[model samples]
Target: MRLALVLGEVAQGLRRNLSMVVSVVLVTFISLTFVGTAILLQFQINQMKGYWYERSQVAVYLCTSFDGGPCEEQAATQSQIDAVENELSGATLAPYIEQVEFETREQAYQNVLEQWEGTAIAELASPEILPESFRVKLVDPNQAEIVIDQISGMPGVFEVKDARAFLEPIFTMINTLSLSAVGIAALMLIAAALLISTTIRLSAFSRRREISIMRLVGASNRFIETPFILEGVFAALIGSALAGVALIALTEFFVGGYLAGEITTIGFVGTSDALVVAPMLLGLGAVLAALSAAVAIRRYLKA
Candidate 1:
């Protein structure tokens, strides 16, 4: 009987403030969608790091005739190459170095040709311009900096390059994008909270006379507040449901259909990831709405 009365009151408040309820729903939906998207993006970022870090190797480039610095415009001699190779096999670097593949200038030139076959770019490349470099595959990619530091000043070394140097910029951009989405979601959630508070205040005002009669009949504040709080929760829950649907669709169409086709090297957030994020969004929406409504109603009742 108590549940029925609260339900009726909740229904009445929703019906009376239908426009405001809809506004709250839409706002919550959009905000939570951004939240879910940010989470999925972070998950994708982690996946990319795991996938790329394993395959990434540190390239210890040897000096060519065109190189400056220690090379002084002279090509690396056989003695210099032997000195660098000695360091790789030595105790100082042996444990860190999994395997070293030496690429001669001729091999590098051929690789260029194979990459750009039938193109003028391939014809313009020459073995003289290419450096004979040692590709050091580390047992642990995290120790790349250590390897780079030790080999950087060695003879015949022009530059110690890591694949991370190329990939860090891309990761930074994606991380910035994820943070931006979180920022936008925060602002939109604030807007939704304010809308919910206003809706509760207006509902309380419209039914002030009935509330006074209920209080006179020995009604408790808890009984009066329950309906208002439930009203907000219902609206936010609907919004959360919509946000979940949008996330699933995005993962399916945008990730599975588009990104999977465009980028074959890395895996992406799938429907299961979306499913994991959906519950978080729903809980966040409900909690935010309930708190906003409770505070708004309590203040109005006191006034």
Candidate 2:
């Protein structure tokens, strides 16, 4: 049968170039793993942004002992606090602020105690030393700088800190890592493509006599090309399958088991995320291999 002969040719090509096939498989595996890591990191970042940013608040720390900005080495008075409250509620900055919660010194101190519970640090905290502050939630989290600028020089205010500022550096680091992974994946894929092209060319060269005889008998281009294309697809599929396994293990053991245990604050990608990415990796590998084989055959193994 035509299908059987094509499969036979594919098997022969693979057996003849087993080393190159294995190399293609390994390269595709590593490259796709990097690609999957980048995607999962992006997903994790989006999840964190949705969870943290929605609850993010701008903390306006009132002066306890005013050393510099809007403070005179004295505790903030009730009138100054009330003035801040009025400003926050009035028309000028009201459009930016969603709501505000005032925390008293005792409450702030209690929060510190709770945070430092059972630690030696708790003993150093005192309610009198803790500055009373206002927690301001913004209508748009991106508008945090606007709130910070408005409240920074105001009386009774020590400094305005946006909760998002604390998170930006961390997120920025994650994004950089994701981009790095993408860059690495791209380089590996290029290597895989070149390796595939070389393998197909070698296979075609080895079978040149057969190809010549078939061309003399008027064999169609599709019939001649199918075996080589299938060989590349077979090698790539193996690599892609290995990559999928590695991705699943990574998500399960590293992200789910290790990271989730260490940082219980945020949810991480799991096996399901790997499953979502696995099929895409397989498809990408197959497509890359097929295209590379076709190009190599057309250019170097022409009938």
Candidate 3:
């Protein structure tokens, strides 16, 4: 009997404030969409980091005549290149240094020309313009710095470069954007919560006379409160559901259809991730609804 009364009151309140209920749903949907996008962006960043880091390598360029040093006066003796390779092979810091390949100036130049087949610059430069270098492939890319630092200042070494160095700035920028999205989502959610609370307060105030009659007839505060609380809860649940649906659609159409193929490393929220987010959104909505109703009822119940 009590449950039925609660349900009936909830239905009545929803019918009376249908527009306000829709507003709550819209606000929650937008807020959660931003929050979900932030989550997926961070996930993509991690995925790309893991994928690229595994393939990262260190390149140690040997001095050539164009390097402008003693290295030019006398081409790096075979002994100097041998010594550097031996030092790398014996290093304890990166026991996983799988192999190092020494590319001569001619081979380096050929590779460059192959990559720039259609470029005008390729026609202007000769293979001799390229420097000889040691390309080190590691079992663990994180240890690249160790190898780079070890060989950088050595005699006949021109420069040390890590493939990952060029990508670090891009990842940092992505992280910043993800954080900014989360910040904006938080602010928007707060606004949504406040709007929900105000709507509940006004609805409860309009129904105060009905509540007074129930109270006068010896109805408990719980009896009077349940309907208002249920109204908020229903509104929140609808909002969460709307948000979840929007997120899935966005991921499928925008992320999967377009971005996924273009950027292999960028991943959207998968089905499993969507399932996980669904409950969180529902819980968030429920909590917001319950809190809003509780605050609104406090003043009425006291009066």
Candidate 4:
């Protein structure tokens, strides 16, 4: 019987402030969507980092006849190449370098041809234009600078290029985008909180006379507050459910389908990420709603 009365009061409050409840729902939905996006983006960045960084290699380019960098008058000699190979396998550098491969000028030119296939650059490329090099895969990719400092001015080397350098800009851009999404989500959540507070205050004001009577009849504070709390909870749950749906759609259609197809080399986030984030968003909504209702009721509907 008590549950029935509380539920009835909750329903009446919702009906009275239907517009405000809908506003809370929409605001929470949009805010939680951004939150999910930010979290999934961070996951995506970590995934890419693990995938690419483990395989990152440092290319120590040997001098060529046409080289413009700090190269000798001629192409690198066989003795110099052998010396570089020896240093890579020697005890001094063994801890840093996991493996090293020597690519001849012809092999380097072929790689350029394959990579730049129909381009004008490929048409203009030649074996003599490319440098022979040692491709060193590091035990730890972050230690590329150590290898670079050792090899940069070595006899046969013209340049030591860390593959990670090319990827740093991409990672920086992704981080910036994730931060922007998080910032937007925070602002929207603040708006949702304020809207929730207003809705609860209005609902309590509308039921002031009934609350007064209940107070006079020795009704417990918990009994009077439960209905208002349920009103906020119901609205927040609806909003959170909508946000979950949006997250699932984003992961499925955008991340899984579109991005996966376009960037096949890297693994993209899937619907499982949405599933993981859904409960967190729902919990956030519930907590925010409960807190807002408690504050409003404590201030306006004091027993």
Give the winner by lDDT.
Answer: 1
The TM-score leader among the candidates is 1
Clashing residue pair totals per candidate (backbone < 3 A):
0, 0, 0, 0
- Model 3, CA-based lDDT: 0.81
C-alpha TM-scores of all predictions? 0.94, 0.91, 0.87, 0.93
Q: In model 4, which residue pairs have backbone atoms overlapping below 3 Å?
A: none
C-alpha local distance difference test of each model: 0.94, 0.90, 0.81, 0.90
The true-versus-predicted C-alpha distance at residue 78 of model 2, in Å, is 0.6
Candidates 1 and 2 compared: the better one by lDDT is 1
- In candidate 3, stretches whose alpha carbon ends up further than 4 angstroms from where it belongs are 68-75, 91-94, 104-126, 264-269
RMSD of 2: 2.3
Those runs of model 1 whose alpha carbons end farther than 4 Å from true positions after fitting are 110-124
Model 4 per-residue lDDT tens digits across residues 1-303: 999999999999999999999999999999998998899999999999999999989999888877766775578888988888888888888999888998988999999999999999999999988888889999999998888887778886888899989999999999999999999999999998889888999999888899999999999888888899889989998999899989999899988889899988899888998899999989999998999888878877653
Tens-place lDDT per residue, model 2, 1-303, is 999999999999999999999999999889988988888889889989888999899998888873555687777889989988888888988999999999999999899899899888789888888899999998998888887887788878888898988998999999999999999999999999999999999999999999999889999988999999999999999999999899999999988999999999788878998999999999999999999999999887544
Off by over 4 Å in 2: 91-96, 113-125
Worst 10 residues of 4 by lDDT: 65-74
| Clashes in predicted model 2 | 0
Number of the candidate with higher lDDT, 2 or 3: 2
Residue 199 in model 4: lDDT: 93
